[model samples]
Target: MGQTIIEKILSSHSGQEARAGDIVVAELDYVMGQDGTAPLAIRAFADLGGKDVFDRERVAFVIDHSAPSPNEGVSALHKLMREFSREKGFKLYDIGEGVCHQLLPESGEVGPGSLVIGADSHTCTYGALNAFSTGVGSTDLAGGLISGKMWFKVPGTIKFVCNGVLPPGVYSKDLILYLIGRVTADGATYMAVEFTGEAIGALSQEARFTISNMAIEMGAKAGLMEADDKTFAWLRRFTSRKFTPVTADPDAVYTRVLECDAAKLEPQVARPHRVDNVVPVSGAAGKPVQQAVIGTCTNGRLEDLRIAAGILGGRKIHRDVRLIVAPSSRRVFLDAMAEGIIQTLVEAGAVMVTPGCGPCVGTHNGVPSDGETVISTANRNFKGRMGNSNAEIYLASPATVAASAVTGKITDPREFI
Candidate 1:
């Protein structure tokens, strides 16, 4: 019996043959905590009487969730994190650096075959680099900080093989939304998802990151793509880290195998209150929107920004719509600025915000009022996710968001492209 990618990674880290359901304590390559969770983790570490972290260089604290201090409470938390980081010698990414998931990889802390964990649920975003990453609670992160290790019950694998070229205006976001709709939220609970096939190979690094970042929405334990030339090339641009790419064996066991043709996929949208409540763009078109947000860890990469800029160039957002554009990282923001994407978006009536989580976490920036409808590129669309239970959030690709912003309605991106 050959091992899947997750199995192989775990086996290597645990020094034993790993399989689904096997509980083992594996050494972690990296551990991270965001502002929303780091305080709890720090308290837990103190309660455990921790004098020093096992590996200060391997731990990080990212201040993004309530960046710029939404209030005094959050500002105090940021101060606490900064003080702790200085004391422990752990890396700290301050506000405006970007979301943890986006900045972590950009900093070269993540790579193939690494075991990474974060206090944020979207930690699975690193799986796009073929790393075995997942989210843990504050206490778990505290434990990892102390021991540089964490326990895991290996998960079964679900293989998604996507082939064929994607049609114009359809993107990785659409493919993920379609899959989540098919599986329904919680359908793949705690299962490892491995994406493969020609279409995945053809996707840019940004698209791959977008796909892996949203696996949690479908209840996946970890969403991964086999590392290839593209993955290595992207990593090279960030760091000189030496990594041996890991791939599932040809005969690796899988709980299920799904085949998809990307050419047939359409732009997908997740309606209010539920990520699985997805529909084709055409089916949801003509619905009015009051706001549109074009950025997040899920789809706020440079490629996503360019896509939105292309759609909005030479056109202004509808008078009734308020559009917000937030790049995922400072590096992305600079690159976009150099390319004039930021200028184009701003000229088209989009408000450019800091390179952080922005409206995605609803902690600050771009929260909608009651009865408003918002189209966003963020991952989740649960009720009240954007700070107000009465305001509805619709999740879509950046292109779709830009198009809808231009029309003040739910418009198909294909119409604009």
Candidate 2:
């Protein structure tokens, strides 16, 4: 009769006992929408005759997907979002502010035990903070904006207990990719994946973000972790918000439990057109690459930049490879500059773009050419994901992408490490 983390959080918000498959109307702590979807939500809100948002403080809009106005049509949408935010007093994150997922956590808007809804599928990224966050459509976002509450069918939890220390050159990204490959893309549809065990605990908060951000690829409703000292430490640097971390009871029922060992795991790569078509680095080595990207919502943090810089230091990227670095946030950009990480990457032949979802969503920047092969630290490898259906994308960890950039092929990071 024990409740899982999602069940417990829903129970608190709904003021009733919650269980798997139970529909409950729960209060939301925060809600967000980004450029790709917010415009629709804004229009939908008007369609619903929405005059004032339930709370300005709890709602946020970010312009990151097609930042700096990729085209006139997008520019007009940006204007609409700006005009609305200005009139309604909701927070608007302009160009260079960062992706919604990164900005919310950095500004302390997200915390443990909070129920959050975002209009972006990758909104599950906040689950690293021990919160239950999920994505919704534009219409649903409009509803939450007006009422500050949403109904949910509590999802069953799937516990993934990772064990052992991650081997050299292998990281949290590799572990998650390996899992997704085994479980397939649609394996965990509508389920909450609770990550636990020794290897997961050994990961940094940034690494955990990379893991949780990709949970949607596996069809997970949310990817969650238990808050510990590392989570609290990261929160302290951002906000003074008081949060009581939520954890599943010892006897909480799980739909399934998977045990994984990362002791001998090598770097993983999800091949083109499908995130589940993954293989070890050795299987895809020497595949020519025209471009390599080191930043996105999944791997654009400071730690990822430093790892790329460390690998590229004292060397230049291959003549055939174009490496792009997109910082996730302005804060991360400024901090990296102060530490000379930016300079090192630029000097090593990496091109730096604005801090946003550059090249990931294929809205504008860093789009690959026809027949081009790109190795990126992005979450998905679906065809046309980077603006061209002809170009192929291979997903890997930051280290793997950096090393591959140096050699102009799919190379393992362990060689440089």
| Candidate closest to the true structure, highest lDDT | 2
**Which run of 10 residues does model 1 get worst, by summed lDDT?**
48-57
- Scanning candidate 2 in windows of ten residues, the lowest lDDT window is 358-367
What is the alpha-carbon lDDT for the whole of candidate 2?
A: 0.94
The C-alpha TM-scores of every prediction are 0.99, 0.99
Q: Give all candidates' CA lDDT scores.
A: 0.93, 0.94
Clashing pairs in 1: none
RMSD to the hidden true structure, all candidates: 0.8, 0.7
* Candidate 2 TM-score versus the reference: 0.99
Error at 18, model 2, angstroms: 0.8
